[model samples]
Target: MDKIKVLSIFGTRPEAIKMAPVVRAMQQDDRFLPITVVTGQHREMLDQVLKIFKIVPEYDLNVMGKGQTLSTITNKVIIGLDTILENEQPNLVLVHGDTTTTFAAALSAFYHQIAIGHVEAGLRTWNKYSPFPEEMNRQMVDDLTDFYFAPTSQSAENLRKENHASEKITVTGNTAIDALKMTVQDDYQNPELNEIFDKGNKVVLVTMHRRENQGEPMQRVFRAVRKVIDQHEGVEVVFPVHLNPKIQEMAQKELGNDSRIHLIKPLDVIDFHNAIARSYFVMTDSGGVQEEAPALNKPVLVLRDTTERPEGITAGTLKLVGTEPQDVTNAMIELLENQSIYKKMASAKNPYGDGDASLKILDEIAKSIKR
Candidate 1:
């Protein structure tokens, strides 16, 4: 059999993290030849994850430019991929999650009459603009996709609800959990981590760079965390701050100057996973962390009112604390004070996966192309 060629495309940190497992899986499988392409939509951050995964893209779109708008990114990816598709002409084009890169790449593949595979497909808040363009991006990408790699059964059902072909949908768990297999190590060391370990403090890993929680909501959550840390003597927070000027400014102003709260620069996949591995708990407004943390046996306190991964909540691995200061404070306090409650959350079975997602994805890809 000829090796099936698959061009896997992604642009952001989250997409890179989730796609790393599938890329690595394909590299080891003799049945497929994977061509990696990065749109450079998130340039530096995307490259950082690529380095961690040791994935050198067969092609880089380099579509990123200063002061680029969503429309600009969408248009550039379509145009850039025009040349890429003409060259690589893979059996399948695989795109991950909802990004301008995901939607545009799928659109371009459709234009060229090539089949597309959507990794992390069928996640929906259904409120079109709730997640900005992401909701629409995934919806449009799915419309063009020939394969659906949903991370969970619920997500597969979501695709079915939208009338996506059930035969095409594969519940492969989340590839992010699979990535931790390569990233988290016992010897992983960082200055902040050493300090936290030296102090023997209960560490709470914090990440709050969501579009919804930008200004006031972010400040509120930061203030709540600050208050909780103030009240708890043995607790410390390590926040890998996002590079967005608005988020940076707010995080520094609200959470800075606190000795217990270490505000560091954004970390790559390896560093972030290592930190999560060592943390006692996690507090975040991001979607990926909600799925990733539980596999490490860390309880995640979601900063949003709702989550697309309700399976985590139902399985007792995640708690949606929202951004309200009082609610956030209460949730934090309950975990800090109640050992049984903390144990219950920390010991819950990870509903996301058992870290075999990459193998499943590769097998499905092989079967799809073989047929």
Candidate 2:
């Protein structure tokens, strides 16, 4: 049998982090001719993860731009991958989660008449614009998908309801859990965040820069976070603020100049995962973190109104505390003051996976696709 040529394309930091494990698995396996491509949808952050995982992409679109719109990103990825797809003509194209890069790459694969696989497939909030373009991107990627490597049974079920081929959908668990195995370390320390631990402060890891939450919602949440930190002693927040100028300004306006709040530059995968491992809990609107935090047995306070990862909420590992100032304040207080509740959440079994998702995903792919 001929080795299968698998083209794995991703762009954003979240997509890169989740897909890194799968990329590494294919690189080591004999059955795959793994070709990696990046859209540079998140430029610096994307490069950070690639370096951490030691992945050198065979192709880079370098599509990130200042003030780039959804339309621009989609156009760039489709055109950029068009020539690459024509050249490689891989047996299958693999895309991860819901980014403009994911959707466009799948479309380009379909155009090339090549098979397409979606990693972390079948997540849905069903709310068209809540996650901005992400919900729609995931839905459309599945439309072009030949294989669905869903991260959970619920995610697979979501695909079933959407009428995707049942046989093509595989519940392989989330690769984010697999990544945690590689990144999170017992002795991980950075001086930027180490001082918080040295002070014996209970740490809250934060990351929020979603399109919809940029303005008022972000402000409300930031204020609520500051309030909570002010009310409690020996508690601190590690927020790796996003690079967007508006987001940085808003974050500073609300969460600035406080010793308890560490507003630092975005961390690479290793630093971020280790931070999650040592933290008391995570607070974020990031979808990947929703899966990663639970695997570390850390509770997550999802700052979004709805989550596609309902399994976490059901398992008590996540709470969807919306961005209302009072609600965010109350949720933080509850987690801080209620020991029983905290313990339950911290001890809840992570429904995401047990850190073998990358191997499962690769094995299923090899079995399904022939060269």
Candidate 3:
């Protein structure tokens, strides 16, 4: 049997973290030839994850630029993959999650009449602009998708509601859990991390960089965080600031100058996972961390008002506090002061996956190609 050629496409740090396991699985499987393409949507951060996963993309789009917009990213990814898709003509093009790269790559595959398999598919906020381009990106990608790899039964049901064929959908769990297995180590160490761990302070690992949460919302959250940290002697925060200039400026202006609040550069997958492992809990406006943090038994206080990952909320692993200062501050205080609440949130079973998502994805891909 001729090995099926599968081209896996992704760009952002979150996408890279989740897709790494599936891509690695395909590389080892003799039944498929995996071709990796990175849109370089996040540049340095994307490269950091790629390096940690030891993935070398055959094509690097290098799509990032000064003050790039959503329209620009979509245009760049579509244009870049046009020739690649025409030349390689793989049996399937696999796109992960709901990034601009995911949508654009799937569009390119559809234009070429090639089959597209969407990993982490069928997630819907239903509100088109709630997550900005992401909610629409996943919906549009699923519309063009020939195969849907939903992380849970809820996501698969979302696909069904949209009239996607059940036969094409596979509930393989989230690959983020699979990534946790590879990243979190018992002896992980970093200079800053080591110092924090040595201090014996309760670490609050924070990652907040979303278009909606920028400006006043972010500033309010930062102020709340600072207040919480100042009030608690044993609590410390390690915030990996996003690379966006606006975000950096805002984070530095509001959250810097405090010894208890450590503002560091964005972390690679390994460091970020280890940080989650070592942290007492997590606070973030990011998507993947909502899924990943729970696997490490860390309670998450979602900084956003609305989340697509409600499974975590239902399972008691996450709390939606939004960006209001009082709400944010009170949630932080509750988790810090209330041991019973913290224990309940921390011990809840991760609703995402069981760490075999990559293998299941591979098996489904192989079966699809055979058919």
Compose the digit string of candidate 3's lDDT tens values, residues 276-344. Answer: 999999999999999999998999999988888988999999999999999999999999999999999
- What lDDT score goes with residue 22 in model 3? 92
Residue 177 error, candidate 1, Å: 1.4
lDDT of 2 by residue, 181-228 (tens): 898887787887787767887999999999989899999999999999
The digit string of per-residue lDDT tens for model 1 on 1-371 reads 79999999998889999998899889998998889999999999999989878899988999888888989999999998998899988999999988888999999999999999898899887878756678889889988889999999999999999899999999998888898888898887788568775688899999998787888999999999999999999999999999888899998899999999999999888888888888889999788899889999999999987677788999999999989999999999998889999999999999888789889888898888852
Q: Candidate 3 regions off by >4 Å? A: none
The C-alpha stretches of model 2 lying farther than 4 A from their native spots are none
- Model 2 clash pairs are none
Per-candidate TM-scores read 0.97, 0.98, 0.98
| Model 3 RMSD vs true structure | 0.9
| Residue range with the least summed lDDT across 10 consecutive positions in model 3 | 362-371
Clash number by candidate, in order: 0, 0, 0
| Lowest lDDT block of 10, candidate 1 | 189-198
Model 1: residues >4 Å from true position, as ranges?
none
- TM-score winner, 1 or 3: 3
